[model samples]
Target: MLYDITHRTTYGYGSDVSVAHHLAHLHPRELPSQQISDFKLSVEPAPTVNTEHVDYYGNTTTFFTIGNPHDRLVATARSRVRITPPLLPNAARTLAWQQVRDRCASDVLTPDSEVGEFRFDSPNIARRPVLADYAAPSFPKDRPLLEAIVDFNGRIFRDFKFDSRATTVATPVDEVFKKRRGVCQDFAHLAIACLRSLGLPARYVSGYLETLPPPGKARLIGADASHAWFSVWCSGHGWIDADPTNNILPGDRHVTVAWGRDFSDVSPLRGVVVGGRGHSLGVSVDVARVAE
Candidate 1:
């Protein structure tokens, strides 16, 4: 599958800004399941300095310095990517999950992918007995690690709610688990935190999911925004994709842009500026699932 993605973000400030430095993770990388054919970023007001480098986790981070005096700033990123991922049978779930967890436990931990700050001690996700209990159980001693992960993922899907307004980025993982309501990002975070609590390495993923409408209904634009998921390291399998939001493994329809230990690391854009009391941010994204 191939896709054309256009993302535009605009910031309107209450006062003029003197200086601004921004970080962007909009570039796509070639993974086991996907490849980046072409990508680019453009900034309005012409940045005084712009540079990009690959982070330790293999994600591209772009830095830009804008000295232009303006009340509003806009940044746009556009890309075209080709993805070819193998489709594993649903029955393979349990085996795949176990494989990923075991592999990650053995290898694939770099300084970048390592869990830095321990949020588990804060009672966010660690306090949840259910998550802890699930992590404790030894499932299918003879089963592959991937399979175990899939089994755990299915349990999460059945137990949680897919509520969009239930939580924010700052919401505690324990609260999210108790409420069982959140978007894909929340679920992904929860899953990562839980895995990390169990001493396994996991990473956050940001990308677009190829969505389909109900029978006879037209597809909606912006109705489906870019999505968030997670990956666990497996030995021979490498990093395996898991969509806790849907209790399924990501395939070709899952277009990955960037990855990191947490959302802060892979945030689409974040920055600090010299002057701006109040600001309004507007984001517009278009992701289309096209023919091969």
Candidate 2:
């Protein structure tokens, strides 16, 4: 499958005279299952300095610096990618969660593959026994790791509320677990913490999910939003995607941008400016699959 993605972000400030620095992880990489055929990015007013590099996790990161500021700033990223991701059956057999976990743990998982590990004490995903215990509903010990993960995903989706106003990026995993409310980010974080607590390695995924409209209704434009999910390392299957947000596996519809141990690693944009105050940000993204 191929896709044309266009993303726009704008920021408005109460005052203009300032400096801004930004890091962008919008570029996609060619992998065994997915390939990036063509890509490009543009920034308005032009940046004084811009640089691109691949991070430790192999994600393409672009840094931009704007000085002699203005009242508002806009950043737009556009790309046309030709992807030939494996079918769900093949992906299940090859990229299964069990397979990836073993490969990653043994240091054999390639950069092109979706395998990663994070420290248990990562800031946004702090570990807490109380929360884990609370989240422990019940599961059969004899179940496969992937099956267990699926079960957990379903439980979370069924029990928690998907409330955007319930939390922020700064919200701790423990708090979200206690409140039992949050968006996809919170769910991914909570799931990561739980998996790690059990000595498993899991990573955060930033991407877009092709949303479906109600039966007999046309899909709405701009209604699709950027999404977050989690991938757990399985001993035999590789890194498998599990969307705790909806308790479903991410298949062809999941368009990945970048991945890391936590949100900090794969944030679409992050940076520090020498001088900036009262700034605002707006982001828009469109992802659609193209027929061969």
Candidate 3:
């Protein structure tokens, strides 16, 4: 499957007087199952300095600065990407969850051993006993890692309500656990915290999910939204992406952009402004399939 994605962000300031600097992670990742054909980023007001680099987590990061004063700012990213359906690892064939956990903690350094970096707490997600308790039911003694993860993913999908108004980007994972309601970001954070509590390695994935319009309805220009999911590190197989929001392993319909310990590490756009005060942010995203 091939897709064209457009993500636009606008910031209207109550008052503005000086410079602004921004960072973005809107570039789609090139993976074995995904390839970016084209990408472009345009910023209104024209940045005086613009640069791009790969982050610690291997995600593309962009930095731009606007030296002049402006009351409004707009940043837009457009891209074309191709995706092949992922070949899911056989859950039953994976090592037992406990073994994978213990081995990940061991000092032995293999090519994939670096995944241990994700086994601990990060800025936006912290391991807690309660998170382990929530995960305990899905993972039994000696259950295969991937199999248990699949069950846990499905449980989250069934238990939580997708309420966009329930939480904000800064909502605590524990609070989401208590409320049992949140958008994809909350669910992904909750799941990552749960996995980390169990000594398993997991990371947050940021991306776009192709959304189809109702049967006879015309597709809206920007109805689709940015999506979030989590990935668990499986020995030998590497990271396996799972969508607790939709309760399925990610495939061709999912277009991965960036990933890290949590959302903060891969936020699509974040920055500091020198003089802009009380800003209103507006975002619109469109993920449309293209004819192969």
Give the top-scoring candidate (lDDT).
Answer: 3
Model 1: CA > 4 A from native:
87-130, 136-140
- The lDDT values for all models are 0.75, 0.74, 0.94
Question: Residue by residue across 171-215, what tens digits does model 2's lDDT show?
Answer: 988788778899999999988888766546778898777777899
**Each model's TM-score?**
0.84, 0.85, 0.98
**Candidate 1 global Cα RMSD:** 4.0
Q: Tell me which of candidates 2 and 3 scores higher on lDDT.
A: 3
TM-score of model 2 vs. true structure: 0.85
What tens-digit string does per-residue lDDT give for candidate 1 at 206-249? 98877888999997776657689987665444567899888889
The per-prediction tally of clashing pairs is 17, 14, 0
For candidate 3, lDDT tens digit of each residue in 154-270? 999999999999999999998999999999999999999999999999999999999889999999999999999999988878899999999999989999999999999999999
> Model 2: how far is 260 from its true place, Å?
1.1
List the RMSD of every prediction in angstroms: 4.0, 3.8, 0.9
Q: List pairs with backbone clashes in candidate 3.
A: none
